[model samples]
Target: MTATALTMLNCHLTIPALYFRGINDMYVRHSRIQHGVGQGSFHSATVEFSATGRHRFDYVFDCGALKYAKLSPEFQYALKRVSLTKRAPGGNKAVLDLMVLSHFDADHMNGAQSLVKRYAVDRIVLPYLGVEELALIIASQADAIDKDTLKELHGLANGVGKLWKRPVTMVKTGPRKTEERVFSDDPQREPPDAERSEPPRTQEFPHPVSVVLESTGAAPGTVMLDEDNLVVGSSSAGRHDTWKLRFWNRGLHATLGEPGIWQDFERHYKRELPQTQTVVVPHHGAAPNAGARFYNPGLNHRPRVNAVISYAVRNSHGHPHPSVLADIAYAGGRLLRVTDDTRLGYQEIYLFRP
Candidate 1:
């Protein structure tokens, strides 16, 4: 696509799509995916069942180690679009509808502060922050971070607090059900009055596609579905043909001291799990994150699903675990790797149809 066409698409239009971007972290890189139909690369994820452009859901997920140098131009394009369209009468509204942190690892969250500093984020989603995690952050960063900057690190430090004044929703797993809490302000009872600043603009470039696009090849040892153009399914009548993207942290059991937390959480979504068109192979396709029961005959109902594995090319952990890949293929799912060799830029799947 030409730069002009890409810019036009980013600013004026919103499409139902998904985008998975590779991360450049040193040891264990991460990736980010957004689902939406907008002209710029930074548009929040959204789902639309029809082409009428009337119905949709605005949301976004995981921010990898994307730098401001790369994201600033897209932000500017979005701002320009908003200015022209009058979508934001006063100024640019929240650029990020939701920021989901799969885990607290630096590779996954290193760009979070930069994201918040650059965009108007509406909400943040993450796994529940427990006392132990907070203690660890404090103990580890106590010397590196000074008292003056400690308060600013509340969200990163505690896993629940304001980032640029945006509310945070922390998900907690339970035996029977999952729970969530919203943190609009400081959880420590201190006033969250950090000054906000605008992200600096740089040379303009087309924002990376925020949504998924069709691909030609499939990863080895997996089956690629041919229904690339199929939108919403017939079963979705009244709903907006939603695409659910879930995140699982490998450290959940360690943090919660409950081995079954992830299992229980999966059980809660079992009914709708099969309907998911794309699954971000949890924990970069770690073995611990994928159990046999998850892909058991009855549980693996989706005839064709995209299993996304976001890992670094030179990963030290040897991610995209063999067992995990086997289970996904056995369950009749395709593998979409976000690494250099795979070059599977972003695997787009149609979530609904008219």
Candidate 2:
């Protein structure tokens, strides 16, 4: 694609269909997850599903850094970079389709308010927590944050709309049957997957495309089926050729008392974990907060799972804990961290259609 053609596509024009046959194609060509570099924790990625080379879903999993100053420039750059291949239609501003606040930790969510104010975010997802749990997370950061910043955080804790005018989805932990729905419009029925005009041929994308994108803390109801694709092997009525991306969040407080939490998250997504090929290690790779089970090699289909860690060098907490490193090594997983190179300040993983 020429630079002009790419620019026109990024602007959401319909000119691509004239030159490319994959304009309406349903299968996911590949997905590239870019981990942003900052002193603290920040993660966001642009998923490209169109064979014609366009990003369909732009999402930010978490945003915040140990140093507040770095958050603005780094996050802005990330936001702009992801928006290059796509922008929400009928809008002058770049659109961020999804924003998931993993937890209320300052390092994980401090940049959200600014982001919401600057960009056009279609939906926001966060773990459902009681007033007490919200208080606990806020209090943990009170000593370090300013009163105004604290107030803004508190506003977000109270209700997402209180701070920003975007819709919010709360994911909670409970029996799989009682999970709350987020991505789907119908609460009772499963969200529709990407549109499939016909069954996928065996020759498409090869066999057993690994990498089950599973989000802990999210219940089965939170599973979002994109309108342009279907699960690779899900028995749903459609061609089983596209990759499945499900979001499940496990609501764990930032404090270190929840060892059994991972188990609950694991059980909630037990049906989908086996196909997992990449794991976005939580809590900046803190063992106590996320545990070693995140790197379970026996269950993950791939020989070497992609273990992505987002943390900064010389951080106060010494993130990407030694234990987490050991867990990845033991599982024979590949460790990719944003801090691996200071100059780039970003790490990426590309998964192509077989």
Candidate 3:
């Protein structure tokens, strides 16, 4: 938590977990992983951020702190709700650390728009080039953005003007090796609520206690399990302060061939550490994010990755291609989908300060 400790971490180390509200949803499943990883260190303070009043496609990402920020309908609703919760004292939810736009598609941008309009974001992160550059999102004749959207873009553009000084990258790195310890917990539903005088409002982050720490500190695959520790609610895993990944859609050959693309994320990661824990899968787990040739894990030393997509089940453009899923398995990473728990609203989490 000091400047010295901060120097040892990866950039991705601090994103508490995030989830989404699935309407016409595809399997983005990001929340599921966060739900799993979060365990019990931080309360997954999440809400249905999307409102019927907003535009259809946009989804936003906010930490109630300013590491990085973006706008979208889903995000806008989340912030409106988060603002009401009175965020934890100093979680950096307000600091503009990084920014990302999956694609230039209006729905995606709508969420970006909302973030730009609301927060003092420092950077903007996006795939190598958004669909707008491909002449698909802004100029697509079949699904061109409408007047209302254009107006939102105008506001977003104006907002972005102030962020010229902030760093933007396709890959983000954050604090270093996080230490983990287990805590007490219960299985199934209903955790014994910690005795807080008031209902948790805003992100009840920086949890005070309740760990189930125990390590044989021995050989591999041989460790004891604490019955009191709820794996779902335990804060035992350690995280590197810093992390790294390449953000591109599909084929590694194409990605590797495109040196400029890697330059962005690489430069960004090197700005701090050598690697990252999570890399936003470039194309929402699509073929473009993978390659025909096998990916060499030894050579790659890939980070803990999970695909983050905001598509619904019946979306015209199918998501989470079979190949992408295989790639994650090959890479030993997890596939997180937003649609996995539409019934749960938005899945939320908090990254601990190691």
The candidate scoring highest on lDDT is 2
Could you give candidate 1's per-residue lDDT for residues 146-185 as a string of tens digits? 4644564564444445545666545443333233212121
lDDT of 3 by residue, 37-152 (tens): 11011012212121122111112232221112222233333445422121233244443223444344343343444455555554554433222333333455225344665443
Model 2 per-residue lDDT tens digits across residues 238-278: 22223343334444432222445445444534444554555
Clashes of 3: 90
**Model 3 CA lDDT for position 201:** 30
RMSD of each: 16.1, 11.1, 16.5
Greater-lDDT candidate between 2 and 3 = 2
Top TM-score: which candidate number? 2
Q: After TM-score superposition, what is the CA distance of residue 255 in candidate 3 from its true location, in Å? A: 5.7
- Per-candidate Cα lDDT values, in order, are 0.37, 0.45, 0.29
List runs of model 3 lying over 4 Å from the truth.
1-103, 111-137, 141-144, 148-260, 271-274, 288-300, 303-310, 340-354
